[model samples]
Target: MRISRLRFPVLLAAVSASLTLHAEQTDLRVSPPGWWAGMASPKLQLMVHGPDIAGSTVSVNDSEFVIEQVNSLDSPNYLFIDIDIADISPGDYELTFTKQGKEIYKTIYTFRPRAANSAERQGFTQKDTIYLVTPDRFANGDESNDSVAGFVDKADRQAPGGRHGGDIQGMINHLDYIASTGFTQIWSMPLLENAMDDHSYHGYAITDYYRIDPRYGSNALYRQFSQQADEKGVGVIMDMVLNHIGSNHPWMKDKPAKDWIHHNGEFSATTHRRESLHDPHGVEADQKAFSDGWFVPSMPDLNQQNPYLTNYLIQNAIWWVEYANLSGIRVDTYSYSDKAFLSQWTARLTSEYPNLNIVGEEWTTNPVITAYWQEDSYRADGYDSSLPSVMDFPLQDTLVNALKDEETWGTGLVSLYNLLAGDFIYGDPYNLVIFGDNHDMSRIYTQLDESYALWDMAMTFLLTARGIPQIYYGTEILMANPDTDDHGVIRSDFPGGWKNDSIDAFAQQGLSPKQTKAYNRIKSLLSLRKEHPVVTQGKFTHFAPAEGIYVYFRTDEAGKGAMIILNKNEAENDVQLARFEPVLKEFSTASRWGNSNKISVKNASIEVAPKSASVWLLQ
Candidate 1:
């Protein structure tokens, strides 16, 4: 019924010419699209696609199997082979491709079965406290690999944006410290190879998609980190970048095609007008500027519109997920790529892992703009999406505004009040990733003007509020980077993490009094969060801010409730508790974390200290 695209006469002539050359024939180049260790069927369906190699047979070990599927058939490039297994086992086996009876190509495949009950089986949800860390700046466990081959930059702790010798072994050593801090998930910046001359330590500009940087560790070491993190009750979330590749990437040396990167020969900088993406009155020039512009000449924007490039990117992500056994993926600069390609990528990933979560970085200060990228939100333009979560930029913007302004008509705590009220704009409000400060901004301590009380109030609101809260590393020890937004200052070396480092915040050795108090206060919150299930999984309810005081509560059906009160005024203020009575339904008493006796909130007004926050457990 179908005409063959390949003419038999031409094909036979080419084969005859090849034989006349007297060249030795070799095996077909076949690769699986992607694979995972565990599956309900304990079987794999590989989508094998390559050049002309018809009548080729597939076999696992010595047994032969037939290809069950042939997709894109008129041209017919793909063949799907499925394998079945009864019980899960761990070992290596070879898969072979043969023609008639002789072998053409053979590749070894490994299946490592996990225990019947593995800690990695746990999935991410609305209930998690995520800690974001930059491994290069977090700590240095092995200094031997600081100066690596093929990388232009060397270890220079003094350089504001240089590598600092942090590796997989460093994180491994701190497993107990991370677990003890009450963080359920740890999301590290990309550890892939970025062999550029400047700012490569940040790990955003990727040189190689498949290999881990030797400076960080080997692929095997990364797998060990995942396994160890799982045992320590901490989930690992990988930072993935699909929009761009390092300029020095090998592909740039000899591109697969001229269309591999956008505006391949022409280099232009982006206008950084993110609003142009959704701007109704925006021009084509604006859209082009946002989409085609270079982030930096070193970070060449990849053209996802190219089918070959899209396949490569998608397969790369799937490979990392299966290889590292990653729990989740945090996509960087999510909106910069082709929208259609993004939908396809998201759909394919979710199709493979139904319940797995993928959070995107939609850095819009407006709720509507950010909400448009979420999974189920309706779009006027009718764009189908498979994205699940987005960073809460509206909340971050409001928190910054509220800290700088006094109580005005629509300002101060009112900014925060109105932001939370706009949760209706989002499809899944609880799935948003909320944070006070991250690697991009100044440290939380610096944002609060180095004021301990303001910092405490910020932490209280972040922890007690809804959505998944992410804490930046070193915030607990009051790391400060004032005046200069130098990333190295914001990402200061962890105290006592290295051998020669005299200052030890972990054991409180040689720390200032203020640093000691801040460390202890943060540690207390970490411990408290673990014991309170309501904080992890609960509905949020906020009360009006009056006289420099704001109140909120997190409650669940299990009768668990925690009250958070923040006072930002210079003087002490008494907050009326009657308004929150409805949430205190069956509770007869309330106890402060450090205090013993139950306090009465029925008809009393509580006096909160100036610029401080207090959390109470209602019984």
Candidate 2:
């Protein structure tokens, strides 16, 4: 059995004592650990854990909070307390536990003060460009905590799958670099404890819901990182897992209920038929296999159908958003969780923070399947989703194929144009998160067969597209995993992230001619998006692809926006201005957005470089 050591939760460790079953007595463990008063929702559920603590009636001595109900299940070690926390003041309250009229346990519960206008906060939007990072491979700012005592995964730079000493301090150390890159937001993989014995660097199998991994940093440090990122004009987006937990999680050792885990805590691999959730004629057993099955034997699928477990997942998500003061969240394996519970989960979160953004990962190349989960899309089955955004897998797939495949009648760039033409299916197309590559797949550079020209065009189109653009960590420097798709190789450590590295990506030292150009071009494109409001809030328009050229435009009603052209020809081509007369006729001249050069539109055509993407600002 994999052993996991429990630590005091971040917000609430004020408990005095509780029933103990071990040789060394430990305080009562509470999830949420604590909560704040004056929240939009007056409800709070606390999952108190210890040894044989059931059959204990809970009571709040103070009138500020009321104990609505107390429930104990088959497990002798767990208690669920429902409290009405509407007007409680910010302080400690004594919770007394009695069994058979005898005081069995007592503890002090803490309530923290809410930040000013917290509920009125907004999440990441089309205006923000997100930089996706893998914290373990990004940088290692601290080596002292590289191999902690409890976590089995140790630091081994030689092993591609082992931890490489990256910590929260590394992210804190690079905020200036991130901000200078012109990205307004950062979405790293989950930083929660993974207490497994092997390959835990990916952080997908979570061992604790309320605590940040010590190998990454303490929970207090994570909060500090979020606050500091805000100082640099960049928001933090958390990656949350709702479908499964690490096999070593404390719950696996002592389940709160018999149905806490799906398939009775046994591993049953998923068929990975994600389309089953939306298939009109999908079989019931196939749907159950897709949702209830685990991704791997090492991770246990959660049973959200259990009401108590549902509350636990929802409250945990809210606690993180409030505790870390995060700007947004990215849900992992969104459809694998129970469908009804997902609706309730998202509704409760948005009800509290009305404008909050939560994007789900619904990895499918079909836009119709993706659209079935967004909030405003009317479903015939009467299922309403409160989710605000989804990762644009269709666009990502089409973009890569368009650039890599040979141009033909229905082959190359035309395929991409046709996909965008179907955008009417999405309720709010602009809210989607668009990207070329992420932590899960091979880097975009590798996918495009290491062609610098194709890489340049891909970056230009995605950055100017109609949705929130996200770029993987090292795309700017042309990181690639050639001849292999191993995740650890794709997520290799950044050049200057470690001590005594010969190459320093952060300082632009020891780079190839191609690498230097790639870095500069991406930085310029990001700056272009950041300074131009039309790129973020304007309507997108495009013309059909003819020959090897594809063109698009983004503009406000007054025609103040950008004109973009992507050329895949082997020779220079003169793009005819007559083809774009509707929006281009009003301007006699165009100013290059990134370089500030001038281009005259007074003639019938303009000459563009071969195999290049160009952008010009128009008013």
Candidate 3:
């Protein structure tokens, strides 16, 4: 049986006899400025940053939180304090810092009450349709924040890689549009401060972990956005980079320890080879090169092996979840960090929020490498990762390949079939996140040679497949980067996202006929998937590809079933329904999902249009 850590009654009795004290201080700063009273874990570590602050004695006015330990690191400007808050009540308390028996400074720390049922909050799951957006290019609702005085990057609508001024307010303004498109969750790229000199619009290199980028919006605005999105039935999934930080991050200027960052002396780029973790005969130096090497010259790789740094990252994650009431987190470059640290980090978060979902990005085309990082995976090396989910890059790669290849034996559509057949290696296939394309990859349309039919088929398969589906921004509007795979082009500004744009996708105005059809098709599929539980939660069964045709079925115990057929041939093909008899038994009628085209099961055959997807509801 699991144990409960918090016994509020016992804690309150132990701290009732303490005296309250207050003092004023200007130099000291605490990360996660304040915390709540009723956390699942009683312990909280505050990193105090200031000039020569390590020598000062630290004490809290309330006896509820006893300073268990005070750690002074190599840098005298930083001090780490471990406080026990298991029994504290929601109220204001003063934390005092003193030198030689004289009070130097004190900061007011408040313990707020947790939201009702916050611990049990449900996270994003397969039932959710995640809409991913690069906020800087989505829309601009608040022009006031476009060019904040202190920020280095400014809005430049003409530059594909420059900031386009899309802020949280813009996302807030289009909540109705997002909901109307049937997306239940929104996953924006990193919204935290990425105070780089150029190309900061991407938001990958974070300079500040605690504060939101002022150009994007204030921290309060971000919280408000999440709150409003929750009200609109949309959950917010934060994007976090644990492996590295922007070169300009404050920690780089004054590192608390010598090993706070890897490769502190000279620049060393990572090999980007993720297979070293499971490579039995792999060289120890190669593995270190992958984990310890910097992603680039500008991004400093964090040293999670340091116990203090590990705790800081873990606490920062928990703080955001509690402060913003987030539903989930999407970790960037998950496998590049220390494996042991990754396990502890995930375990801590899951312990606090049992239902919260955290999906890690393990960008590999091999299923074995990706599966090795998932929780409960049986690895021969005896390494256990507490990660709940991983990006389905293996399946993603096959999906695109299957669509682009020519129909042949042991090739083309068969590649996708083979990929799905390998699902047994995963701890939980349903928890994996599958997407057609993302900010880093070429657009789905471009990948499919700009074929609208192939694009439709791809969308249909992603939504009906087993794992959680993520749709990149502008995908529904047929966004394409046909000429190049450059990230700037792939993540170009969405139509009508900026003012004076020729096209507006949000309103469905100024779109071409083909674009309109693609948009409507996505909308129809998303709406249908939302209303049907079988697509999201039912058992997934698939058939082998024959003559460039692949078929799959999702069925629940109650007899509700969905049949999805993908026809890759240029000429129409008649699919023999007998091939799917295992799932079709006892069902007499079938109808196309988006239209009222009746299909007769008695005929024992269905005609599928060339290079098109046909989804039918079986009854």
Q: Identify the leading candidate in terms of lDDT.
A: 2
Model 3 accuracy (lDDT, Cα): 0.88
418-482 per-residue lDDT for model 3 (tens digits): 99999999899999999999999999999888999899999999999999999999999999998
Candidate 2 lDDT for residue 182: 91
What lDDT does model 1 reach? 0.75
Clash pairs, candidate 1, are none
**Regions more than 4 Å wrong, model 2:** 1-27
Cα-based TM-score, every candidate:
0.85, 0.96, 0.95
Worst lDDT run of 10 residues, candidate 2, spans 1-10
For all candidates in order, the CA lDDT equals 0.75, 0.89, 0.88
List candidate 1 stretches off by more than 4 Å. 1-34, 37-121, 283-285
Q: CA lDDT of 446 in candidate 1? A: 90
lDDT, candidate 2, equals 0.89
- The window of 10 residues in a row where model 3 has the poorest summed lDDT is 15-24
Model 1 scores worst on lDDT over the 10 consecutive residues at 62-71
Instruction: Please give the clash total of every predicted structure, in order.
Output: 0, 0, 0
**Model 1 lDDT tens row, 478-580:** 8889899977778877787777788976567989888888877777777777788787677888887776678888888888888888887889887777878
